[model samples]
Target: MSAPITVHRPSPTGGRRVTVNGAIVGLAHDDRDLAEFLRRAGLFDAETILDDPRWVEWRGGRAHHYEAA
Candidate 1:
């Protein structure tokens, strides 16, 4: 409904924290991969996630996986 909010955590801590409306939604851990952080945060939307390797072959496939859960 609105633009995504990004909470940046930098320095010795070496990571970022992302939240929605002050809720502890996700941690952009420096040690961990960004993708994992996003997945854990449940940020990726099915409509936007694309399988670039085979997008044409997999039309709407991402929606199926995301919707299944």
Candidate 2:
């Protein structure tokens, strides 16, 4: 099964689109923003879970990369 959370590629203006269970959550420019999104989604310890494959799936670019090139 795929991860429940997906961090899409960064846009030309920067920031990545985040989704949960196939529904749009918000745009995250950095780890802080991502943690907040997860917090709103009822996920605690989001920082520790960010790199966990079972929790998040990074796409289009490497994880934590928010600059379009």
Candidate 3:
């Protein structure tokens, strides 16, 4: 199984950081950018990514969540 993707929002700056299996992938400005990064990394597909509840959680400003995409 793939490692769960962890999304973190750091203090002050309010930037989004994405990490897979403990390795930092990239910092995203928004959900769309995060999805695009995941797609390029072969973690998730375009069809179900945006519509998934996990993505919705992040968009809602949840600090952290484990997404096993």
Give the TM-score (vs. native) of candidate 1: 0.35
**Which number leads on lDDT?**
2
TM-score to true structure, per model:
0.35, 0.94, 0.57
Stretches > 4 Å off in candidate 1: 30-42, 46-69
lDDT of 3: 0.57
Task: Give the better candidate number (2 or 3) by lDDT.
Answer: 2
Put down candidate 1 lDDT per residue, 1-69, tens digits, no spaces: 333433444424344454443455554443233345445656464224323332212222231122221
Clashes of each: 0, 0, 0
1-69: candidate 2 lDDT, tens digit per residue: 999999999988899999999999999999999999999999988999999999999999999988864
Q: Show where candidate 2 strays beyond 4 Å.
A: none
Candidate 1: RMSD over Cα atoms? Answer: 12.9
After superposing candidate 3 on the true structure, give the runs of residues whose Cα lies further than 4 Å from its correct spot. Answer: 1-3, 44-69
* Order of models, best lDDT first: 2, 3, 1
lDDT of each: 0.38, 0.94, 0.57
